[model samples]
Target chain A: ETAVFQTPNYHVTQVGNEVSFNCKQTLGHDTMYWYKQDSKKLLKIMFSYNNKQLIVNETVPRRFSPQSSDKAHLNLRIKSVEPEDSAVYLCASSFLGGRATGQLYFGEGSKLTVL
Target chain B: QQQVRQSPQSLTVWEGETAILNCSYEDSTFDYFPWYWQFPRESPALLIAIRPVSNKKEDGRFTIFFNKREKKLSLHITDSQPGDSATYFCAASNNRIFFGDGTQLVVKP
Candidate 1:
């Protein structure tokens, strides 16, 4: 019973190409986050959106952007994908934003490979 | 600087043996500590969590020992089984959850 969902279990693209990953949550959470996991399995928070407001941008490149159509949906778009962008993209959602008390429900993840 | 540091990049234990995964944090303001477990090709899921108010929390075979003074915590898996094999991450947060590099554990049957 996965509350969060991500499309395209895996994607392989070339450098300079634009890519988009879609994420949706049915838990009715107000906060959504995007995290990148490298080959070493280190998870880093890239961006977070609370009530459709952007927060917690961790020095991500301008090419990387997040779009939220509504609170339940947050999408990640890479304008020009680079080889270094090859990693696992995970989407998670939680309730509220002040402090994380409840667990964050995560999607399986979308694997991106840029050659 | 890494906010959280986890030890033994990887660990292996025999079935039925207790396995301990250690973690330390640099942020004193972190009042909440949670441990997440992830399997290959799956997203990390919260296994158990503990607040600084308590020194220990237990759920079934998983337990979290917290040291608020030392800014450290450890996860103890009692009666470890093969199904417990996975990467375990230790996270701390006052506002946002900050995760450690994670420890890959393997339980040999």
Candidate 2:
């Protein structure tokens, strides 16, 4: 099954709580990305990693951090959840070479709701 | 600042109609443009894509019209079905991809 996988399809927590989302890809892609989709459907990039090396880090808050164990695994951890942090966190992966360049395969995003 | 912009935050159309979604970008260095579609409670999937070298690309009922001179592109979903109802995201890529605030399309049967 060549696809991206995300655990905890949905989660609900109160403010000041900590949460973590895990992602893994079996498509053998080189790059993995985290995108935050707000209630308004605005997609914002949070971080990107290539081969376990940080490549692109957007203007996200310090409370948010991304951990990559290998090219296939990327995890997001929120130290202290805020009300505004409630959104669908999407994990995507892509290949940088060959004919299928720029094509992103996404996981079934992890939805977070802060109370 | 939004690097990629999309218009008509929401659109409602009848089945078998053509739904046109508009998009524009700010960066000229972006050579790749792709449209991703997300169904309710589902993650986004790549629907169609186009490069700057070509002004148009088509797959099935979806077509992407690109204007590199103006840094604008549009997606046309012809013969839209109720299953086509989803949020469409326009994205541009250089070193990293920038996605626009998606346009929600509702196809009524």
Candidate 3:
């Protein structure tokens, strides 16, 4: 069973367009994270939310923002997508403020392509 | 700056042979190290992990060897099979986790 689910498994959009990716976790985990994996397969943390509280922001561009409606849902919105914004966006969830021992559960990932 | 570095961006190993992937980190605060394995079109999953207090951790055929003084670690896959072919990532965390660029491993039968 997939504990975390992401919508629009693949997205293709034009430059300067705004796109939003939705993520939901059925695991009831308190913490959700957004990560971007570039073509080179470098995974970077973009945002982390615990109980709707923004805990970590990795100095991402202002165009990128994360919104959490609740503990189970965390969404990523990108305004004016650029060529560099084309990458795989992954959503993961884990227990809140817990030791790193708990492995993060990840969705298949949403691949974004900007033309 | 890249905190965690993985070597041999790609590796090819024969069936039943042992494959070793190396990784090193620069942050001393990173007390936890985890290895993740990712297959094509799939999300990365935790394979094995080791803490600074332990020198080695083993699960099934996967093992993680850690060296705190050297700030280095390595993953060894014993009796590797073709199914083991995938991209392996090394991640370090103090408070937030950081992943290495990744190492693609191809295991041929």
| Error of model 3, residue B67, in angstroms | 0.9
DockQ of 1: 0.68
Over the stretch B27-87, how does candidate 1's per-residue lDDT look in tens digits? Answer: 8888788899999878999999999889999999999999888888999999999999999
The TM-score, computed over Cα atoms with residue i paired to residue i, of candidate 1 is 0.97
lDDT of 2 at B98: 83
Predicted complexes: DockQ each: 0.68, 0.56, 0.58
Taking all chains together, each candidate's TM-score versus the true structure is: 0.97, 0.95, 0.95
Predicted structure with the largest lDDT when compared to the true one: 1
- lDDT by residue for model 3 (A34-69), tens: 999999888889999989999999989999999999
Tell me the lDDT of model 3 at B65.
92
Better by DockQ, candidate 3 or 1: 1
Pairs clashing within candidate 3: none
Stretch of 10 with least lDDT, candidate 2 chain B: B91-100
Order of candidate numbers by TM-score, starting with the best? 1, 3, 2
Model 2 chain A: lowest-lDDT 10 consecutive positions: A95-104
Model 2, runs deviating above 4 Å: A97-100
Clashing pairs in 2: none
Off by over 4 Å in 3: none
Q: Candidate 1, residues A36-106: lDDT per residue as tens digits? A: 99999999999999989997899989999999999999999999999999999999998775275847889
User: Between the candidate structures 1 and 2, which one is better when assessed by TM-score?
Assistant: 1
Model 3: DockQ score: 0.58
